[model samples]
Target: LEGADGPGLFNAAQTLRQLVTRESSKGKGSKGDKGSRGFAGVTVRDWPASPVRGITEGFYGDAWSQQERLEQLDFLGRTKQNRYLYASTDDPYRQSSHWRDPYPAAQRAEFRALAERARRNHVTLGWAVSPGQGLCFSSDEDRRALLRKVDAMRALGFGAFQLRFEDVSYSEWHCDEDARTYGSGPKAAARAQAELANAVARHLSARHPGTEPLSVMPTEFYQDGATDYRSALAEKLEQGVQIAWSGVGVVPRTITGGELADARSAFRQHPLVTMDDYPVNDYAQDRIFLGPYRGREPAVASGSAALLSNAMRQPTASRVPLFTAADYAWNPKRYDPEASWEAAIDAVAAGSGTEEAREGAREAVHALAGNDASSLLGGRESAYLRPLLAEFWAAYDAADSDKKSEVKRLRRAADQLLDAFGTMRTARERVPDALEREVRPWLRELARRGEAGEQAVKMLTAQARGDGGAAWDARLALKQLRADGPERGAVVGKGVLADFEKRALETSERWAGVRRKAFGDQTVHGGPTARPDSPAEAAVDGDPDTAYRA
Candidate 1:
């Protein structure tokens, strides 16, 4: 706020649980009193390590609702994110088909409202246009169309702009003028793109004056090192125009400073902006990534001009990872992903109903994030459950190999696993409804797997007690639960939990002398069905598409 590149501020209130403290006098206190219960003044010097740290709505999926965008802006502000870029692939007004058309009145009104909300939150609204599919770069008419579109959007309060050439051709020409002005090849395309980018960026500097610099997503936005196209663009593109890259890969598992240096070398003199693609789930729409942001070196934050993370379709659900990303961007030197992760869960769960309900929501969210933590970032699925499962097996093995130990050890382990399953099964009901709606599919799957897990534990525990009758009944109930659908819907507790159920059921079926599959022919218990033919063998399916009343 002081100069062209002055310090910025982000007051992230969502993570106040991190700052929460219980104070009482130290040493030899009453058993109930932990610390002096009083507020203490503190001086916290908070600042972002990266200049531009935020998220981009650039996923290829259904466009987010206007209200969703408003919530996202608030989230960004509360998470210390200072920028939000609008670049959904599905938005036609910003695409090649309609890059020049003014937004419809209803949409224009929505954009203005979004801008005001962003301004209130101190978020700089940024927009990106993808006009590479049919743009004749050499044509004066096309250039004017783009500028006019930018002018209208600038009037609506967008503070930054980006030209996206990621989806454009490298060797083909769209028009006769483009072919004559720029020859066929990657280098020629890069030269033409540089010509346009420099002009637009220079225009922004001259006309907008104090607005943020323009950025461009090059044709090789995700590649490693220099190339004919990258070199050409690097040599010819304007110095102040930022080059946006998605690390060494489109969504690299980890971005190190060495890679950033490589990227800078490739882009030459232009300032580099890193568009990190995490959490966005268009490629795997059934799941949401709720893991902590990690595998990035500290220099990745310090070196980039701006670091923008990509978001998922579910706006509220994206906040967990986004919150951690902001923490890393704010101070990568002191970042602790696991600690930041726990804080993120508490932050998001803080809004759930009453005190008791908020506590429940926190537990539910923590359990959910643990189970759903695996992503392209590549970590163990069900990280929390893994240790519990391992403990159960170890206790069971100890009890089996030596016959004199307390069965309490085995039961205790099983109970812990069951409690974890119970949390997963009921998390949806406990969390905020807005979050519940976004994750219903995945949560239901988690519940199904949890139920199956409960039955599996019952089966094994009964076998441990030498109750053949009880073991058989538990196995049959598990079979019935499996019939209700264990393999349906979104993925949760993917490899670890499913493997436990499979191995448990297999061991149950292979029991030395227990009877299995004892069901006989069925008969109707009540006269309720309108169609007698479909009565006892049928199910009252909830899905209307598959259910016929008759």
Candidate 2:
């Protein structure tokens, strides 16, 4: 655990934790100090592919709680992510309106404590200040005000700083000084912004020597080719000051090596880093992307000076994808997104002691994550349920000569689908409470989706077995559930599961529309009658994860 810096030990500790599993917390109030590992007589020495592999809390909407920030810093350390940029766009002290002011005493205290936690986790704490909206780039007062803000932030243990111009207007200037000093248009805005960044970089170099190089998020952050703005920034911005680009769009689906090279070439050799905006759902606040990082070439990691993910509002739930992003950032060449995603799911779900079979939290988390495993980056939602639904449909659609045998086959398919829905129904109850809050809506939708599916399956199966009363009731319940199923923002199982239910409903309706007269008032048979205390319907119910009198 030796290095020129003190963080090496923290990293080594993280590595060691990965090598062992805690085995002792099976009992109530147990210390859980006991652990075991398969690896023996081994030493691991490692380094991340990218230098700044961490998060930028740079999303829109609500800022994270103080506890969330602290937890995020710890997560970064655990994953060997060495930097954490504090830049929640909604945080008053972080943006244009309040960039000149200091944090309140309470927030300042929180920042100091965050810094200490970051230090313990081997994370470099950085703060981003967006002053472009109100800054007169040419004004002496604005320049010093920005610097004073930086100094104040530094005093609270921010080791690095980023200047954000991503949200500012290109045609407008904050003061008359900006139009007078730099002239007008995109090129002028670029030139002015570059000079301001240069001032801050030089100031940091002189006063805070050896701290991380200053970074700037350009107004033309994700643009292609060499524009007037790019050219001006290329020529004027200090070389050591990092340029942050968010791929080719605010949240692009793909970022290739060639595209990155092109963007770097456009910027003309300033140190370039990617502030990849995956898993950040600020624009679409209804979702959380739990998929593994994808569509990035290996060189995207090796080529960048650093790679930072913009995190979601939900800190704990954000770990699912952020973990994969960190894994890719550390070693992109060997990354397998699916495998990494599964491991990440395990790592996160394991925290809530969700290790049981069937309705356990692990499967529940998988359902929750798999159903939400999509974002701007592009992934299949309901990945876990898709195959199960397919299997059910395959069996349901199979052509069978024997009626009873076919009913048996269809029932088997329906049962598997129902079991999966069971997991989805109870997903929220299984995870940690904090994580539950962030994902409660999704979990609720998942449960609703599952319940709707179960009703559809039951309705179809009941009709198949010539049970008139049961089939009618199940269909009625299913219709009502479907009516209630239109969630405002949160979606689970996406379209496919709904399609399956829709098809089932249509097939049942179709059968009803073309039914024979049942050969002169014959009685229809159904499943076993229910006892009063435990209704037969309890078996198909969403919760308790158990069948009635099975």
Candidate 3:
């Protein structure tokens, strides 16, 4: 800590804070504890692997409230993140639609407060402007408008600036002025963007001396190899201006050292920074991803100047992954995703300051983490359900006497899971209100599904034993309960229930056919399918007649 400066010093302070939190939580000086009274013999020397490690509120959703943003700044400080980019798509002024508009009095005040908070937390607040949508790269008026916006934000105390030309078409100039000035082509587009970025950097320096170099996110920010536009941009852009890249794809599954090297080469090594889109569940709003920040190799830290995660819309849930991102950015060489995930859970639980609260928070987060619809069968929820499913299926496929035991076991497992959900629902005081609000509906639906799943298992058992009446009763009960359909406003667990319903119905139908064959010359009352008046019933049975009616 003695020699560290800038981000390094911030990282050291965070490490010390973590160490203290860990030690105190161990009851080091408590009356009943017999541990050491002083420090727990912990020694720490730490620095970030990347120079700039932070997050970008750059998702497409309702922007985080001012209070949420303030909390996020504090969270960033706690995790040793040294940078924060304010580039939410929800903000019109931040992007092209209203690029020239100044923040209103109240919004400006919020920005001022945010900037002060960021300064206090030792985080560099970077404001990004996206004017590429309607900009005339050749007009003085456009240039002035762009610089004026930056000047306004600079007056509010944001020293770092980024010009984002992403997601906009550059096939032809938007304005006739630019079309006349620079012909329509990739080279022209790159030249225009690079020149404008250089101009912004120089303007900021001249107006606000000692400001950090400007950052730029190009239109073609992701590529496996260099292109003509990239080469033109590299040739035209200033060396002091940093550039942001989002790997080979916008949301790449992986970022390797070779990709970083390619990006460096493509950008002519203009202090490259990674704008990672992982763990940002905005695109997949139906669920929240609580998994570790992964896919980027450790070597990426050394190859890039910095790594900044683009967070999910749910700020509280995003913390689970951001914590791991911080750990990886701080020490990628020895980073372990699983270890980091455990540490993240502990860190979140530590905030509660009570053993019961910690356990409750951990369980709640663990359940919510499985809400990632993208990896439905691969998360914590699936892990919990998979074993029970295997047991139920094994027992069903076993001897006749074993079916009853297996069915009972499956019902018990379902009840236990439902009970866990009940505990999570009732532990609202223990978990963060934000997280509780974000995940409550999903949990409710999960409990309901557990109930329905147990019932479905029972129905299957009855059908396997040729008890049509029992099977019919169980099916009718499940339909009446409306447990097979997803809960209203629930983003996760839709696929989970849908898959279960499909498999259960298929298995039930197959068993019914086997029963009919065994009885011989029998008539099937429902003729392979039954339609109920209730929409939920239709939903469960996959009845086309009422499937889309609701």
Candidate 4:
């Protein structure tokens, strides 16, 4: 325990399973209705220490079997997780335009029957109906086709629907595919997206009356370009359409907290809905590289909190729904990522922590490191080697050529790590932490380099884009003041060449100097500072604004 790395934590979990489950089995517990072991008076402080709980549903539209759904639901209910947002598109009940094709009218009745079955299990089936051609208006026929699907959902007891436009049209074309095919711009796409959402909402409101409200995934417009989406469909968004916020290629676009809040405020006034979409990124949008089955390694797979926090930092006018890519297409809000991972692990464990259980723990720990490595590295530079290459873009835009060359080298390293990850993913033995210790320092170095690289790229990108160096520099300085990661401290502690870099580094060092002695001795080499002193408890708390102004 004293010398644990990612693999160590994983092995510890494995050993803990043996200790906990074997101990659990030795005692004969109260018999259940079916003679299954049952616990009596189990007191649990069960809750995610974080606010963002992820919903994961089945993959490839496959039914998760009713047993799987129930198991996940039970754990989530215990965890107080409020959102169930990922239902697979291939769900048996999912209705496309040609409903008659999948099943005859009589068999379709059975699909409707499953809707109640879903609700009875404390799950709401979010209907996924394609409203129009990619971000554009569909023919009157297709529109009616979609409406019919919505009508069926109401009859079956669905409360919400997301006009999922991501897969329907031009990959990154303006909002609507149908419209884009007809040569439309952002405004046209927005109008179509907004109109379709409103039509569905009106139908649901009238047909079901107190059913859940309606929402849609605004086109991929927010994915790139155009700061103010208003020009495209601000009016439609204002009119009550929901916009889906997703940062597809890289980190979230640098829009400030205030700007996002203001946009949400304006849209809410129009009776509009605003929601963000977060697809777990370690793989391509369509596929997730989970271990053995299509399941992901545990750590990278359990990214529900990170997604939730991305939304939480914004205005909560409405609870924004986050869905897995496919589930978002199926009923949008029925999958739970955390529950999914736990279920997968439990299934693999099979109610016991044998050798297989240890292997599962090992995989889970690997995920934790991979997911946390990006943040730990500060940016991309230090973490570009093979397994970590997914984080490569974080370093690619370096202003200095030498730094850029280093990024390429790191990417090659990441490739090797990924090869090992693939082997470890299927390995049966519980591997030791030392097996991967060779890359620990490299990962740390990446974090150090990433911090400096981020600052440099921020400045150069701004200048290249002609945003005026001084204003961007000033904004950059302020950002550094509030930023808290390994890279910032390292750059500041060691010093970087650019004056702004030097200044940011100085401020970082000074803050650390005061906060270190105040909070506790600094522990930079291993990881984030490990002390219990809150910001309010620190000496700097005496003058909050001034302390932040540093």
TM-score of 2: 0.88
**Candidate 1, 518: how far from true, in Å?**
23
TM-score of every candidate relative to the true structure:
0.88, 0.88, 0.82, 0.42
In model 3, which runs have C-alpha deviations exceeding 4 angstroms?
1-3, 23-39, 349-354, 373-381, 391-430, 453-477, 481-484, 493-550
User: lDDT value for candidate 3?
Assistant: 0.74
Candidate 2 scores a C-alpha RMSD against the true structure in Å of 7.7
Q: After superposition, how far is residue 516 of candidate 4 from its true place, in Å?
A: 46
lDDT of 4: 0.38
Task: Output the number of the lDDT-best candidate.
Answer: 1
Worst 10 residues of 1 by lDDT: 541-550
What's the alpha carbon RMSD for model 1?
A: 8.5
After TM-score superposition, the amount by which residue 85's alpha carbon in candidate 4 deviates from its true location, in angstroms, is 4.3
* RMSD to truth, every model: 8.5, 7.7, 6.4, 20.5
Q: Give the clashing residue pairs of candidate 2, or none.
A: none
Residue-level lDDT of model 2, residues 345-435, one tens digit each, is 7677666642353226567778888888877788888877777778777776772536777767787888888888877777888866777
What tens-digit string does per-residue lDDT give for candidate 4 at 1-550?
Answer: 3213442343334435434544454453436433233344333222222222334342332344444444444433322343344345554344333431333576446545545544444444455554333222555655665677667656655555656654444323423445444455555556666666777777766777766556555555244434334445556543444454433322342333343444444344332222222223222221112211112122211321222212111111001112122222222234454443333333333432454555554453343232222221032211213323324334323323347665565444435444443433333233233222312332343333334444433443333333444424644554563354442212211222133345533433343333333336532211144233533234343432232223
Candidate 1 per-residue lDDT, tens place, 232-322, comes to: 9989997788999988887789989999999899888578989999989888876789999988999999999999999998888899999
lDDT of 1 at 163: 94
Tens-digit lDDT track of model 3 for 87-195: 9889888777898999899999999999999998888888988888878889899899998988999889787888888876767678777888878788888999999
Question: What's the number of clashes in each of the models?
Answer: 5, 0, 0, 40
